[model samples]
Target: MLSKHFRWNKSRVELLGMIILSLFKIQNVQIPKIAEGIISDAKQDSVIKRIYRFFKDQLIDAVEVAALVVDILSLDKYLLVIDRTNWEFGKQSIISSDFI
Candidate 1:
């Protein structure tokens, strides 16, 4: 799916590899942690920055990718967990985050 959307070969491979690493590594979801688990290099910070840039660029449609993931997961029974958090800034109320 990513291969069809991501323009760069490096981006496609990195995205797929990181996803696979996340699935295997149950520790933390942070970029540095995930990069350490997958990459053999010592410079995890650089790898993390690269990953940040890849996502910051928004090379593909996030909504489409999310729908595709949900559809694929629906094939088998699974637990879907969502966590919501509310935040306040100054006198204004910021939108709550929806985490899965």
Candidate 2:
């Protein structure tokens, strides 16, 4: 699929390498591990020769779309933070967020 869209040499590395690079930036993680994880996920797909190449482009596109949306919104100028002195949580699922 990629070969028809891109030159053979670059396209060959596009699926895995590109995805790791893209995911690294957005997720702030390592490359080799990311690539390995991706490979494991795609191990069952016999037709998709390179799982790395497939995810690499998709991850990059997703981040690019997010950045585009932020640009379109341009909400930084109007940003504000409001604090509440009293707060309570009841009967709700709790999810931990590390990145604020």
Candidate 3:
């Protein structure tokens, strides 16, 4: 389904799936924790690096992602709620959002 809209190569799509699964398994968005949850033959550090590169490269388009969600849910009409928050997680400044 993702391949139809995104230009990502097969491996990238697979990596995205892995990341999503890991997020569900661990219920955390932090890179290190996500990396820890990932099941891969690659080294943990390598997986972490790959995840960082995935975001750093900006491979995802938000508009396309929204469209994909709509299609998946087969929604004709729906309410969208988005909440944005800015805070500090340890020494790092974090901006987080929830969309429903």
* Per-model lDDT: 0.64, 0.47, 0.85
On TM-score, the leading prediction is 3
* Model 3 accuracy (lDDT, Cα): 0.85
Error of 3 at 17 (Å): 1.1
Order the candidate numbers by lDDT, best to worst.
Answer: 3, 1, 2
**Could you tell me how far off, in angstroms, the CA of residue 20 lies in candidate 3 after the best superposition?**
0.9
Q: Write the per-residue lDDT of candidate 3 for residues 72-92, one digit (tens) a residue.
A: 899999898856556668977
What's the CA error at residue 83 for candidate 2, in Å?
Answer: 35
- Model 1, range 1-100, lDDT digits (tens) per residue? 5454445677556666575667588477777776777654647777777767766875566666666676756656556664465666986667555431
lDDT of 2 at 51: 49
Task: Write down the lDDT that model 2 would get.
Answer: 0.47
Per-residue alpha-carbon lDDT of candidate 2 for residues 6-45, written as tens digits (9 for 90 to 100): 3436744455455545566547454444444443435434
Off by over 4 Å in 2: 9-26, 40-100
Number of the candidate with higher TM-score, 2 or 3:
3
As a whole number from 0 to 100, the lDDT of residue 9 in candidate 1 is 79
